[model samples]
Target: MPRPICSQCQFLIQQCLCDHLSVVKSDIELVIMQHPSEVGHAKNSVRLLPHLLDKVRIVVGETEQDFAQLKAELEAESRPIYLLYPSEQSVEASQVKHSQQGILIVLDGTWRKALKLLKFNPWLLSFQSLHFSPQAPSRYRIRKASRIDSLSSLEAAAFGLQALQPQMDIKPILSAFDAMIEQQLVHMPEHVQARY
Candidate 1:
């Protein structure tokens, strides 16, 4: 079945409310592995993070060949890689896996999809996973979560980059993300926005 047009904007779901679109400027590189289903999700902010910072890259799709190619490029660089996740098997965000350049791999999708991406891409498991304890609520209203400290893709990049480079002021980026989410929520119907 064709997806319903967004009631408020009359645009296709992919173009309606794009919360995922963000700008990023950071010293650390961010590689987002996004799920196909999350491409249009209003709460997915991976696309937007690169605008806020300068050091961001995004790759969509989940395939062994793609992961292998990414791994080859990353391995050639003299940097440490980290998988940004909140699991018992993860690493702390406070410490850098390597003193050289750091490549942060983030899975931008639902929890289940994220797990699938991680599991399917065994090369990602070789990197130390970075997990954090957030002091704020998530701004992603369209997506439901089992955790209160959940954050949007942009938020994760902002915080992760900040942790890596303490000299940068990442608050403004996060604020912009929040403002964007608020604007999107205001345009959405009360019932849909209420879920946030």
Candidate 2:
């Protein structure tokens, strides 16, 4: 039989980590373009964004048509929007400055898939890009990522948003990520756990 799931965190009922969550209550707007393959995947990190940023929006699709509405909505907003992606053209997240809060767009998927989203949605390139100089390595050890330095969407959101809004508290987001990893770790075999 399938274990009952928590409607909020989507973890098994017994494994629900919602108790570890605390509301950040920030006005920071976040739009996450999630690859369809990642939508319901258990390892998806962007799922944790709502617990941190109450106003986060997650759109599930990969092509331009999938994001046309989002693109139009973004165009109507006069506030600055920054894409949290790493590239030679991207500046450190801390360098972005504006008089008012801005929106953050993040791609949620593996490195290759994320690049594919970028390719399929060229409009995403118009936004200013920002990257992080992370203080630590990725905490998402349960899943394999293409690059050793790749961070989960939740981690990138927390760090990237922190750079833009220096006063926002990100510990709750990070703690939830750790707790989820620990939950998944308990289910893995000793051999699988050793690889991470």
Candidate 3:
């Protein structure tokens, strides 16, 4: 039988991360467009995002039709909507003007899947794209990244939010991610853990 999972934390009963979560309130609005496959993936970092941000919307899908309503909602919003993807046209996150709180949309998926999501949802291209150079390497050790500089969605959001609002504490924003890594590391074999 499958191990019982916590409905809230989505981890095995004993490994639930709900208790490890730390909340950070940000004035900016965040919208995470997650591919369907990432919803329950063990190493998925987007899981820690809602616990980190005070205001976050997690929309799961990878198609234009799936995101139609969200697109409409974004279109109607008066606040500046920015896409957190590094397109040829994207500007550095630090270059973003920080006058007022605005909606920031992040794609939560592997690079290939993120590209697929972008292709499927072309409307996303219309928004101003923002990219950031990772200040540090990824703490996401369990998964292998195709690129060296890639940060997990949680890490990306944390850094992105930091760029948008320099006053935000980086520690609390990343506490759950660190905790999740610790939890996963505990389950790994010592020999395997040593490799990471």
Candidate 4:
């Protein structure tokens, strides 16, 4: 039988994270493009982003139709759209001034899947791209990353939001992220858990 899920947080009852969450209103809107494969993933941080922020829209898929809808939304809004993708052309997140107003699109998926999403959506190439030099190691302990600089979707969003809006408090999001990591660690074999 499936485990009982928490209606509020949507996590299994034993792994519910409602108490750890803190909701905050954001000046910048977040448009998360999630790969279908990430849906219902136990450790998917994208699931927590909408819960933490007041303005978040999740679009799932890489089809032309999906891109069309995203494009329409972008056209409807006057805000400049920025893609949070790391590339040679991407500017440091900190460089994005607070004066800038617009949407931030985050691609949520494995590196390969993220690349596929970009390739499938040619229009996304027009958006400004941003990246961050992580000040600390990623808190995503459950998943092994090919590169040390890699961060989970939530971490990227938190860092990006802080960079764009220096005054915005992101402690709650980070606190909840840490709580999720700690909960995951408890489920691992004691021998496999990292020692601090």
Candidate 5:
């Protein structure tokens, strides 16, 4: 039988992250487009983001049709919509004009899966794209990234939000992320944990 899952964090009851969650409200909206394959991945930080932040929308799918409601909402809103993908055309997040309120769309998946998501959702091409230069390496200890610049969904969101809203306090969200990583570290083998 499947282990009992926490209704709040959706993590196994024994590994529940509910207690570590820190709720933060933001002026800028976040839309996380997660690939369906990441749904059950234990190290997927995207799963923890919504619980910690206000005004976050999590959409699971790889196709335009799957995000119909989100697309409609973006269209209806007067604020600009920006995709947080590091494409050649993307401008650095720090350089984005702060004059307008906007929505930031982040694709939560591996590099290949993220590319697939972009391929399937062509409409996202119309939006302005933004990228960020990480001052430090990703703090995602549980998963191995092929590239040093790669960041987990939560880290990307935190950095993106910090850049978009300089006044926003991201400490709570980052603290919760660290707590989750610490929890996952307990389940890792000694050799694996040593690398972190």
Candidate 6:
């Protein structure tokens, strides 16, 4: 084996491409919950995704129990809840409009980690699953996925919010994220050259 190379962008950097970030407008409240390992990880994008959006909140897990409480608190806001996980059995977010009284929850992690979250947290499963079909390959260069349709948290947020609020111009936010990624990538090669 070639030391378990990153499947996405194929660069290591702790296998993350999270520096690019954006926030989108949505009438429904959006919450992104990430696993514990992701907090200190250089590639972690979950934290950045929420900051880009107007009403997005992100919470990282220090313990599963705390995250559970947080989820309950978020869900208690008296709105329809949906989780973004693409599955044939799951209800797609595009198929339904949340209107004024809904909350959409997104989880960020590796595929295995996401599956673990779904397995350990039954309350999370209680929400209707929000499935999305993206038109582009994930911009994340660090970790690869089997599907080109998969997108980063920020990218997904843009598409989802665009779907929800067609009037909002989220282009600037997306452009900013793209610039950040390019800047970071440019600096990375120089650092490598210096070491050689």
TM-score of each: 0.80, 0.94, 0.93, 0.92, 0.92, 0.75
In candidate 6, what residue range of length 10 has the lowest lDDT sum?
A: 2-11
Clashes of each: 21, 0, 0, 0, 0, 8
Report each candidate's C-alpha RMSD, comma-separated, in the order given: 4.7, 1.4, 1.6, 1.9, 1.7, 7.8
Whole-model Cα lDDT per candidate?
0.72, 0.87, 0.87, 0.85, 0.88, 0.65
TM-score of 1: 0.80
**Candidate 5: stretches off by over 4 Å:** 189-196
Off by over 4 Å in 6: 1-24, 62-64, 190-196
| Model 2: lDDT to the true structure | 0.87
Please name the candidate that would achieve the greatest TM-score relative to the true structure: 2
Q: Candidate 1: worst 10 consecutive residues by lDDT?
A: 15-24
Error of 2 at 155 (Å): 0.4
Write model 1 residue lDDT over 46-84, tens digit each, in one string. Answer: 655655667777888877776777778977877777889
TM-score of 5: 0.92
Winner on TM-score between 2 and 4 is 2
The lDDT leader among the candidates is: 5
Clashing residue pairs in candidate 2, if any?
Answer: none
lDDT of 2 by residue, 44-152 (tens): 7787777767779999999999999999999898989999999999999887778876799999888989999999999989999999888887888888777778888
Error of 3 at 10 (Å): 3.6
> What number of backbone clashes does candidate 5 have, counting pairs of residues 3 or more apart or in separate chains?
0
Please, what are the lDDT tens digits per residue for candidate 3 over residues 59-144? 99989999999999999998888899997899998888867789889999999999999999999998999999986789888888
Q: Cα deviation of 61 in candidate 6 (Å)?
A: 1.5
The residue-level lDDT of candidate 6 at 135 comes to 68
Candidate 2 local lDDT, residue 169: 86
Worst 10 residues of 2 by lDDT: 46-55
Clashes of 3: 0
